[model samples]
Target: MSFDQLASELVSRKRADLYRERRVLESPQQPEVVVDGKAYLAFCSNDYLGLANHPDLIRAFQQAADEYGVGGGASHLVSGHSFHHHALEEELADFTGRPRALLFSNGYMANMGTVNALVGKQDAVFEDRLNHASLLDAGLLSGARFQRYLHNSPESLAQKLEKTEARRKLVVTDGVFSMDGDVADMPAICHTAKVNDAWVMVDDAHGFGCIGATGAGVAEHYGLSVDDLPVLMGTLGKAFGTSGAFVAGSETLIETLIQQARTYIYTTSMPPAVAAATRASLKLVIAEQWRRELLKSLIQRFRDGCQQLGLTLMDSPTPIQPILIGDSAKAMTMSAALREQGIFITAIRPPTVPQGSARLRVTLSAAHSEAQVDRLLDALERVK
Candidate 1:
């Protein structure tokens, strides 16, 4: 259809809600930032560790730029691969306790690359109903018989699995749901996959660098080994305080993706400086335990305060605590009300969430202080 026709159709169906406007940011990612010339306490970022503005990471990026001269200059398969990328990949392998690791330009690409490469037309892919859009899209692109289970329900997964007859069965889920902030029932899901002889993959985009023992992510959080969950995906931008993402698994898995994953082979590599900064950030994420602890405290404080206010919060123990507002208009109103008080939070509506389940995705960061959490709670109470 013509672009104008498509635009009109969108407006008619109210899918024009997809048209989001962006505000110009004039400062580093922190508790407060300058947006559209107004200073606001920003809660919309994924920088859970609050290391995006750390001086050490900044120095690491600057030093790497001085040495490597910024751009990667080519794709990973070409001349773009550098020492910074190599070192970071090795470090990530170590971080996840995997035999090898491979980097991708972003989390979306990583998910698409791994899922598409691993399973093809002959396979069947089962996913959580609320998995990230990337996973669902990847399954579609794979030409696999894609099916979805009820969110975080292993019984639902098994019922679907019982009917599938593909040559290979794959189960994928988000480690920590981005909007709901709840963790997957990994032990149950992984156990089900194991009994069915299916492969399990987890996209721990929001969990890595933020959860588990020593920040090893969801698998570690639940004490699942590489055996229980063989495929692991993590994004560096969220908590590692840098750009890009990685997949850690068996050597054969890494090599197969390197050889077969179109997304990994065709795209330009991430900046070498970013890899350097990720390395530095990884160090801090491990060495300094206070950040995670403080985040845990903040999450508890927010949840407790919300319960006291009688808000319909989701079942979440993580930092991404979303307040479920069933009406999209109400969600938007809550967002605007908070913004008026200098607090910035994004309202998530369908189809990012289900219809009639729009919400304020209140993300907490380690940079947030007790006073900041109280201020946010006070503002929410006023508007709610």
Candidate 2:
């Protein structure tokens, strides 16, 4: 089995500017980071609330590590479900305004597990055309009848929902679409789904810790309850500034997942220390309103600056602002150019984005000062 064809395919991707490489991160996640042995003002992090390196979260993790040790040791069904994990799930349930919440190792697993647990061959899944890869993969893996509607178009969703004759129909979407940074019209979607007798699930990975008044995420922003959005999923890594992911919903829904979701039942639970740190992170997420407020301000500041530069921006009110570059090779060049100027924003190209829509994915954070944003704007002016 010579991998000659595989090697040729890799070469083709590189020539087409589609090859992806991992940059070595040598420091903790923050506005300023050491990557590939050089310090850069990083603008591509998902740490929207800037709590990833918060002193309190760090201290809590260290303290918990002393008590619970490092690894999860076993699956949640075995000895790995520690006190911290149990407590965090309770806190998450309360935070999300759901009856119960179950934790998974990561967002991908959470999506895959929940979707598979809820629907099967006789059922169907409806999703946004622009859903995150995890949700799309989950729908495909569940062996359900999968269909995608136009992005954020509740009318399109309703049209599809009206025609599906599957046993169970689950409508899935991203609360805050990860790449474009635009939010889904959850109110309209929920209403349509309810009318059509379909279950609604929102993967709010980017919404948690960023949107909503008390950082309860998009559901809270829209005043939606468990009855409105039946399955709510969020990742701890983004706004919560830790790691792991969870699904919050009714007790029956959660227990169903616990029993049937192989991703959750068989995988090692997240480390108890991470659960402890996330508990601390959750406290900050709720108590520190100023963090979200600062994020709001920063997002506006960056957007305003981009507008002045006459740069094409997506309809995104979130911190994830993508500057449209359109050409994949040029987008890669622009990313490197910004890096040379000590500003780090990654070029997101196809198939992460559709063809002819390559972009410089500029993510803002509360940790960034207005001055740093200005520096990026200045660099963008030079590059563009």
Candidate 3:
């Protein structure tokens, strides 16, 4: 708790090779980026659809800014809500096939607020072991009896659910595991939760705008309806290539959050221009099916090339492909070696991932060409 203890802990992290730092990105999120005066073929961005710097989105943002100014200026309940924000929420609700939707400043606040609003001391919350940090923290902050099931194990979840005697039960999981890049077995989880009379919540932050026919995310990918996955959370920042988050569900569910979610009620709303830009991005996400196709092709190409080189990869059909290197030091060394070859891939170490499972988190974007992917494969071949 003391400053001296914090310094000692920082030193310990540095010694263990578990310390994390940020790279100064000199350019926008793209396949090729300038970092600290050096250019690199980057594979670490989450702009899966390559819409982060899209001209249309920029234009939409600019137009909205010209009309509405730069800031929300207040929280949603305090007159910060604009026509742009309302329209975006309506569009999201329609796109997700939900009756209503509510926007939050970011995904972290959305997750925290949603979970906290739904459960309390007399309730029980069960989460997958690999759920996002925000989900875990929300569960703890809810004052619920929180328990974690084995990762992606429906049977484990069922066993835990059967034992909970709380007044309300909530089962939460990430639709796509961020570090592992594997989709959750939502059908099984939903079935188990349904039988146990527990509500299911999915934070499909990474899955949205990258999965499904119209990029409706994991629920749509699995053909799940609103009844099956009642509480759904998606972020605009990742594949949508904007900056905000939303929870889409029943009208009652949204109204309940509007009344009870502290994070949404207390924090200032996101910029109206961001909402306008996201509206533009959402249109592209729905109409431009080719972006998703290109991303899938890139993912397959990268996986095939890595397999041919005998590099270990996680079971991921998505854009996030992690090359497993057991030791943290080895992962860092491989990342540095790739950087020397003008490739920019980040080494993900504990406690992001489990101990002894440090990896190079190589992400793919639609903006990257096949030749660029080949270049990355070639660099990875050398580094590995």
Candidate 4:
């Protein structure tokens, strides 16, 4: 019963290669950040809208902290839910054009809580093979019969659904694939779900404030309504540039989660100051549409540059652009070379991505300049 040998065994097996060792970040989340006391142009953050360091958000957080105390102190079902949280939920519901919305401490909890609450032991849950780990984990924990369809293949989902004999079926997928940088085929999936009498859910964590007109996310991009894909989950920490997550859906869905979602009912609510900051982030995401435009231009610029270099890149129309390097060690080597050039793009290896398809997840932000993109391209060419 010696537990101390486990670390040695992992290191010996080289499975420790999959470990992510975070660098010490010494500044706010901006286009440029100091890591390990070295300045670098960071391309690894989910802050697509660049509002993380906005002056207005900081001021709102400061002001809210002065009014509301720092800690939430209790769970939402108790006395933790504050006016800030309530206002943000209302704003989110309105933003997503849903009847109601409920907030969770983070996107992981939001996905887990919603899926586990909606599907029971006897139900069937079908997910994309490449869906986020949180969604897959929730499906397993829900005691439902879990199945995975081929990535982005509606036909595969239909086949799986046709075989399942459960009375209730749910199909969930990531609106924007995180590591691949590609979007889910929402229209096809929704159509398949409708034809199969299955409910569809979209975790639009990367799309909420970065895709579609007014940043309404993937469903809106595909012109799907609440009736088409009823369960929508988005994270405020991504494009919103704050912390926390929300599920936007029909009134019944929200009320049911409030009552049955163990993660939502048991965990202490997020700080009101974070909610206040998220309110500011939401405002900036909507009013400052120029940010999204700038982000798009940067993405296009990088894509065009990568194409010119003949580098292997994914076909993605969002800010989460990935450069596919097939070998895990090769991807890590490329990432390290870029880091030496003061460019921070993290290497995503298995089991986050497929074994042979590890990549450098080069995410873009509105705060980054065209010159910076060009510099990244130049550095990439040198490394290539």
Candidate 5:
């Protein structure tokens, strides 16, 4: 690999307006933020319930840090699992209505470890085409026969399931598709899997702390028990406003991951302080029904505003609302236009989305006022 080749590729990416950059955040994870020395009303965050900078979580984190120190010091199997980690896992298992739950450093590791541990050379894996990158990577690396069905289409999944003769069959999907902001058809998908004698897994990374009556995620929202969805993977970073991830499932499933999952066996545990903070976050997520209601109202208002502006949005009931723009460069330009108006929305382009389906991914939070949403709508009208 020559350096010139890399430079040429970078230049080509720039020409295509596909180059990526990071903006420096000078404030907490809130609606109003200072990025790159400029203050903007940003809508590109995943903190749906707005608990990231809450005082309770902060106090919990600080107290836990004072008691437990900062670093995990070792892998969970090698003496890193602290009281906070164990308690959080138990709390999470109860929260998700699962028999047991296992914690991982992040969602990627949780998905990778669980899938690879469950399926092997003689087994097969099926996933939705629009699943998050973590699920796709897990399926590919599981050493199982991997197949993809149509997005949220149980018929497509059934067709694939019928053709496979592997010793074990696993069906996987996102409870909530991240980029599109649409909920998966779990009732249909799970039924298809059950008839095929396949186990179902749902990565509810973007669903929890926002959906469901008590914020147990899509599983609770759809009334699916642990029997309906076996391997449940969820991330704390997004909705919980904390860091780490977990897999809630049967006792046998968790034991299998603990014994066979290479990622979990080899990796260091997350900080105890983070786990302690997540405990606080979980309490707020469950108790605050008003937060969910406010999110719904905000989403509806944004959707109605988009309709009035004739802006085509995805069929998403979640807090994620993307305005589709066909051309990548045009999408980038539109994002820049919004930034100029002191509203920060990033352009989502190819590889993240399909070619010519570039979009401006507008994520909302309960922290945002209706006036802020109106300001965004005004910016959209002007940008249009």
Candidate 6:
């Protein structure tokens, strides 16, 4: 808590090349952006289906603002639950094939609130080693006996769950590993959870608007149902191209969260206009199948190009492709070099990733053309 110690810690981080900073984005979230007064072709956004700045979404937001004003003035438990929020929740439930869906302020709050609501001191919370920070933090903050298994390994999960004697057991994972871009083995994980008498929770933040035949996400992509993968959480800010998150499950589960989840209970609901915008984006996510197809094509194109370049790529079929740079400084150098060439790709380092496994997280979107992807590849090759 002392000022001197904080300054020393900051100096240590800088010396270790682990200091982090944020860039000022002047433009809207899209493929092309202006960062710190410089124009660049950005590949770091989570706008997978290219709906972040879509005209339809903009119009819906504008119309909703005209009708409902801007803010949700109070918590959902108070007077903040607008018709727009209720309608979006219902639409999300239908979209995900769930019995009910409860909206939260964001993905982090949804994960934290859900885990804490379901588990307690006598319960057990198991998670993937490489899950999103939100999931990891939720598990720790739940005050349950938290344990993490190897990344995406059902066998590792089974080994840990078999010995758990808690009153309730919850196994959590990301539907699509956000950093690695690979998907969790949903069928295998669900089977393991069943054998251990534990429920499964999947946070499909990066999958919902880009995967499956109808963009139902990893659960639908693997043909898993509400019974197989119970507790589905997705973020609207990512693939949905809106802002907020939700948890979908049976009626009992959602109602339980509404009554017990502190995060949901205390936080103000998202703007009514944001919910309306999500409704519009949801329509495009389902009706405009071309976006998904285009994203798939772009992923394939980038992967094929990287393979030809012999770049170290993770086994990811999703839009979140990561190139392993191994060293943190090297990753940072590569990122700076790419920016110098008019491309913007962020270098992801520990403790976000494991030590000695720093990487360049190259994400794709439906908005990017094939030529743009090739340009990125060209820049990467030149940097190399």
CA lDDT of every candidate: 0.92, 0.95, 0.95, 0.92, 0.95, 0.94
In model 5, which regions exceed 4 Å deviation? none
TM-score of 5: 0.99
Model 3 stretches with alpha carbons more than 4 Å out: none
The TM-scores of all predictions, comma-separated, are 0.97, 0.99, 0.99, 0.98, 0.99, 0.99
lDDT (10s digit) by residue, model 2, range 4-37: 9999999999999999999999999999999999
Show model 1 residue runs off by greater than 4 Å.
13-18
For residues 1-384, could you state the per-residue lDDT of candidate 1 as single tens digits?
459987787685565354466789999999999999999988889999999999999999999999998898899999889999999999999889898899999999999999999999999999999999999999889999999999999999999888888899999999999889999999999999999989999999999988887998998899887888999999999998889999999999999999999999999899999999999999999999999999999999999999999999999988898999988878887898899999999999887999888999989999999999999999988999
- Candidate 4 colliding pairs: none
On a 0 to 100 scale, what is the lDDT of residue 43 in model 1? 81
RMSD of each: 1.4, 0.6, 0.9, 1.2, 0.8, 0.8
Q: Is candidate 4 or candidate 6 better by lDDT?
A: 6
TM-score of 4: 0.98
Query: For residues 1-384, could you state the per-residue lDDT of candidate 6 as single tens digits?
Result: 569989999998888778999999999999889999999999999999999999999999999999999999999999999999999999999999999999999999999999999999999999999999999999999999999999999999999998989999999999999999999999999999998899999999998888889998988899888899889999999988999999999999999999999999999999999999999999999998999888889999999999999999999999999999999999999999999999999999999999999999999999999999999999999987
Task: Estimate, for each residue in 1-384, the C-alpha lDDT of model 4 and write its tens digit.
Answer: 887798787685475467667689999998899999999999999989888888999999999999998999899999999999999999999998888999999999999999999998889999999999999999999999999999999999999998888988999999999888799999999999999999999999999999989998997788888999999999998889889999999989999999999999999999999999999888888899899899999999999999999998998999989999888888888999999999999999888888788889999999999999999999999998
| Deviation (Å) of 322 in candidate 5 | 0.7
